[model samples]
Target: MKKFVLKPKIYFNEGSMEFLKEIKGSCAFIVSDSVMETLGYLQKTIDYLNETGIESAVFKEVRPDPDVKVIAEGMKKYLETQADTIVALGGGSTIDAAKGIIYSLWQFRKAAGEEFKKPLFIAIPSTSGTGSEVTNFSVITAEGEKVCIVDEWMAPDIAILDSTCIQHVPQSVVADTGIDALVHAIEAYVSTEATHCTDALAEKAVQLIFENLKALYNDASNSCARERIQNASCIAGMAFTNAGLGINHSLAHALGGTFHISHGRSNALLLSAVVEYNANLNSNDSRYASEKYARLAAVLQLPARTYREGTINFMQAVKDLLKSLGIPNRVRELGIDKSKFENKVETMVELALHDRCTPTNPRLPSREDLVGIYQKVF
Candidate 1:
């Protein structure tokens, strides 16, 4: 009994932004971060939207790791203009802000007795990761905890994947975000909830990412790599949204909330450790888990002759990938002290146990298991 939903009308190419002019809407509000505005992408998006004879407003205050306060403020701006549609431009932050605004607006309109039309959101991702455009999940910080919003209605109406949008991204961003997309594919492929549909998507995503992530990291202007990574991100997003993620994301959320670490880097630090932890649980003839490691190792061109060897090689490959991307490999390398991490380990474990994504994990952890995993990463 596997059912899923991926309802976005996507347009991809060099100039898909031109499609904005044909969308029927009264006004289009854009949600973005300061960096996107500096790059002139936001203005370009608004100019095209206005070509449709639609009025537009820009809410360019979406911060990195956007919080509930920011979402509430953006919603107030949305209400002031009574905008009927939204254009999210930039990376994960901008697309995430758009989701927050949509969720808030839905509630407000319902309470005010207005037509509760779902805002028409068109996402133009400027990076090749997070795949926030295609999925209905939005992670917003509330009271220092990252919370997931999972309403199917929050999925964007249109997703524009123009690889040219990522042409000017910094090398560091290219490396971090690219690894994040690869992690998404690998994690979802091994998920307990993974269906045939998700497995197909995840396998393709993994193949594409391994083929192009390094090229993109070294040469941002490589158009071929850009397109491949862009497609990989969307595929990974679709797979993970339906199949769900594992301990890597669960621990990353906690680290991001407590230490204010970058999301991708946090995941980079814990991914291999978490993979090892889960692999250890497959001792009792968990053939599915063993098969997952074998497949992943094969993708990396490793000799996976046995389950234990396969899992070890997979973890080694992940570690090598992060090192090549110049990402820190340990939690302590991020400048956090040991005492603080120890003190907060219990709380982090508790929060992750209740996380929306944890239940679908192939090997659900007990409290002791969570504590042990944290210690291993530490």
Candidate 2:
């Protein structure tokens, strides 16, 4: 059996903020980060929610890679306020923090023999990556490793994508997050677990991103680019959240938790190499893998005459995109010594093999294969 999970209420277009008035609650618990608050986004969301006559309070404790301790602290605040609803206002990390808070709350209540009540939740994305607003997956770091919490019931009731919120995102963030969306689409489409619905979402997302990411990177004022990227991010999120991701994400997760590298940036740096390595795993499967890569190359208008040419073009395009975006191209460029990476490759392999995202990878990498991919990227 196949199941597709998405937000119950999705509002898009000009002045979607009007949906705020329809919120059915007395108090709202907002989860956000300092960046969004500093950009005045959190305030804007609070003001709008307040206009709906709902008293609102914010838990601005969400960090880049939401840690278990941070979530626990937020849950403490949530329980204290007795808020009936959660309004997550920011990127994936902030929305994910809200997920952790709600789940922990239910678990805590259940432990005390109290019935679990679902919170009326709304997610408003400030950035175009992460699609956390629409997905049921929540990622949190525990014991210096990133862990994914999956449950269909955790899907938000509503997802609000406002292009205006993306204006404040920095250029580097745009590049990293945009690449994150691209990686999500490609990985999902190529995933062994992919379904028809996810494939459609992923393909459209890939097309949208290849067309608009550069424009958004070059000019934030371009609303057309902003809207496309935002829409693509959500579509990619929906795809990967259902079909799951692959080695690129698994490796990125390890790097994020271990070294504090930004999740999207880590993914951006590693995606091309992982894709190439996976495609090279078997000659018979080569054409199948190369076809999607060739399509990617064509979408970006790179040079590609054959499957081999397509693979090379796709790799080059990804590397060029990362360089143009001012992101470091390799783990070594991020200041980690190459030797450290070589020594840690085994551990990374073990962790990645067990990652929830790994089973769906087009290439089911063995420990040695993971090491080889890491070494090449390193």
Judging by lDDT against the true structure, name the best candidate: 1
After superposition, which runs of candidate 1 have C-alpha atoms over 4 Å from their true positions? Answer: 111-115
Model 2 poorest 10 in a row by lDDT: 281-290
Instruction: Estimate TM-scores for all models.
Output: 0.95, 0.93
lDDT (tens digit, per residue) of candidate 1 on 234-290: 999999988888877888888788899878777777888778777774577466766
lDDT of 2 by residue, 48-118 (tens): 77888889888998888888999989988988888888999888899998988898888888899999788
lDDT of each: 0.84, 0.84
Position 173, candidate 2: lDDT: 92
